[model samples]
Target chain A: MNIALKEIVKNKVRFSILGSIILLVSLLTFIISGLANGLSQDNASLIKDLPSGQLYMNKEAEGTYNLSRIDPDIQEKINSQQKEAVAFSIQMGFLNDESGKQRSVAFVTSTESKLFQKVKPGEIVLDRSLEEEGIKVGDTLTHDQFSGKLVVKSFVDQKKFSHAPVAYISMENYKEIYRTEDMQLVFVPTAESSLLFKDLQSFSNRDFLKTIPSYSAEQTSLNMIIWFLVVISGMLFGIFFYMMNVQKIGLFGILKAIGLKTSDLFKMMWTQMLFITLSALALSITFSQLFTSLAPKDIPFILTIETTLQLAAVFLIIGFIGATLSGIQMKRVEPLQAIQQGEV
Target chain B: MLTMDNVRKTYVVGDVKEEILKGISMSLHEGEITALVGPSGSGKSTLLTIAAGLQRASDGHVLFEGENMTTMRPEQVRNIRASKFGFVFQFAHLVPFLTVEEQLILMLDVSASKMKKNETKQEINKVLQLVGIEHRKDAYPSSLSGGEKQRVAIARAIIHKPKVLFADEPTASLDSKKSNEVMSLIRDLTKTLKMTTLIVTHDEDMLRYADHIIKMSDGKIL
Candidate 1:
């Protein structure tokens, strides 16, 4: 006799209200988490796609990547010492097409390495997003400061920086446009943390991303909202079961009087919690995944299976704690009181 | 058979001590119905609860089949209550969500009965028929009338075939006609099952069904 399941089946309206609330809360959480991830990818996919490594910037830059300019001598020395090391620089600029349409882009130039696209002085590589905006391979695009026309060589996928498309240009063109020969940073691929360079500070790939303005602030706020929703769902379970348990106090007392074990009562409560949570989560996962596929192209939304499972696990654990907290009252009920209090 | 020797129950409220049952001794024989009749707060209900192991006596010995229940551990007592004792409260107190059939099934599960599934179903139907409510076995407590709900409660109490049955104001919520029906049903079941039955009630008309009557007042039996 599965009394837990029987009760749920008997009281459809009461349980459905709780199930719908959980469904809405979990769906909102998944969607928000997806947007946060999408915005993160849009904000810094260029740096995020790099292999795990150490980034060296001039110590005087004070954690600001744009302000950091690595000396040419130090860059060359590290490049010679670590064969995999690459020196790179990025600057926000504009590219004008043949029709004079100005498109914002992050101009990037790096030392000869397989990690970045190699472009000739008179050629450029563009991000795929720019190709979608009417810029194509072999199109001649010019910059205001360089005074030269560079043909777009090809396009790379997902290479974005600071919410703008990346344009891989030659070091010579970059120097001409920005007037600097020194690169902003040195990246040593698969480098150990103990390695140190004089007059420079080191940051891991993850810490380096924090140096990008708006990245940390944006991610922090979105993550806070996701966690708040998770916690509120837990509290919802606590209060819901608390109210339900309060209403059933007399019933519980009668059951207890009739020789039902306290552990049996707890088992019933747990079974109901699992049933409700898993059902709501299954629906929410299905709906959120559907939203991911149907979302507008301009909307940054990327919900991964791994993140969904992790959040689901958290909701289950928190719900268990919440329901168990409310069940403490069941252990305190005296059958004599219910017997004396009259009908259940 | 069950025996209560010098049973005393004391309740304390705000530094004031009140004795509800003052060292009362009684015994219930097998295959008989014993009624504890009294006015309000006469401790008949309290005595019934103590004998049924729902609570502990402040001081006394409760012996069931020659085993001292008051000295046993709480888990052991609860085990006895589940496997050897049955209870019917003042109100029907039927589980609101369960149908009449499921209520009996729940009791069988609580008692850890060894009957197979088909046998258990047969036993439930048998008890429901004995209480004259077999036609309403599929109904929930809310759908049942006052008389029908009490019949289901009685069916649940004895479905496990317990050795002792404890009822506290079993038909207090029903009218005089329905009360007599319930009382007669209790008497017939007690004799038919050969089970020891102890009931607490203040109604004088119900005493005719009891083979033995212990009237209580001011915490002492007269």
Candidate 2:
């Protein structure tokens, strides 16, 4: 006979209260996690989309990607020695359409490499988000500093940098528009060793992303909230089970007196925890997945299957730990004390 | 038959060593109800729990069917308690979540009985009928009357046909008429099942049902 299941069935209202609380908390967690991931993707999808490698910049730039300028000699030597190495630069600027509408964009230029879009002189590839805003292929967009009008070549999906749509321009046009001959950064795809050079520093892709202003601070606060929710849910389970276990001490003693194995008592607690957590997770996962799809276009809410599964596993482990800690009382209860205490 | 030889229990509080049951020796025969009567601090409950394997005696031997229990491990003692001994506490202590029938089924499971599913159901029905609570087999403990709860408790106690039955103030919560009914039921079941019974009670009215009454004061037989 499964006494644990019977208890849950008999006391439906009480267990439902607990299950509802868990469901709400889990749903809130999943939603917040989705927003955090969405914001991260919004902020740095350009760098994140690249293959793993090292990003080298001038050490004198003081960890500011915009201020970094690699020497022409160093950039050329590193590019020749490393396979698939590309020298690139990004500058936050604006484009003027035919109606004089100013659209913000991160102007990007890279040497010959398959990882980034290659455009000829006077042509530009823009992020698809700009197309959603009414721009189209072959539309002429002009920069104030350049003499010639650039025609839109095509659009790529999910190409963003620093919360702005990226515009890939030719290396010659980038030099002419920015009035600079030196590239800001050098990226070597899948490079294992940092190149030894004077007056240069190498950063992993993740470390390079932190050099972007506001990315670290933004992600740090959001991640802290996510983890705090995870921990709070764990503590909620602990306190809830502790209260239930306290209420059931007399009953546990009597059961032990009647020769119920201590292991069986633990199994009952674990079964209840698993049931409650999995039910709540199922509801939350479904709703969160729905939220990811139906959320407003402006809202960056990306809740992926992998992230949801990871968080659910943590919740289960933490719930198990909490319930097991509360059940320590079951092992210590003496039947004589409970019997003398009268009715349960 | 169950025999307790030189059973002793001493509890140390702070710096004082207080002996609760000092060198107590007793025997309970099959088909007999032996009542242990005493004042509040006379250790009657302690002795009962020790004999029922709910607690360990500090020193001495508890022999059941000629095997020494004091030397056995806790799990082994618990196995014997589950299979060979039945208990009814001062309160009914029926699992609040289980119905009357499920309570008996829980006992059979605890005892690790080898009876088939149909056999187990038949046995539960038989015991429920014997205790006169068969009609309420589907009722939860919360819905049962005080007297009815005690009857279910009794049915749960003997569902697996234990050799020894222990009752510690089994009717302390019932009225005078209900207590008499519970006592009569216990007495009738003790005779019918040939179970060795040990009961601890404070009410003088309960002593009449005991086949051999042992008066205890200050942990010793008087």
Estimate the TM-score of every prediction: 0.98, 0.98
A144 Cα displacement, candidate 2 (Å): 1.7
Model 1, stretches more than 4 Å misplaced?
none
In terms of lDDT, model 2 sits at: 0.90
The residue-by-residue lDDT of candidate 1 on A168-225, one tens digit each, is: 9999999999998789999999997899999999999999999999999999999999
Question: The CA-based lDDT of model 1 is what?
Answer: 0.93
Query: lDDT at B132 for candidate 2?
Result: 94
- The complex in candidate 2 yields a DockQ of 0.85
- The residue ranges of model 2 lying beyond 4 angstroms of the native Cα positions read A193-195
lDDT of 2 by residue, B1-222 (tens): 899999999999999999999889999999999999999989999899899988889999889999998888999998998999999877898888898998888899999999999999888888888999999989989899999999998998999999999999998899999999999999999999999999999999999999999989998989
Candidate 2 docking quality: incorrect, acceptable, medium or high: high
TM-score, model 1 to reference: 0.98
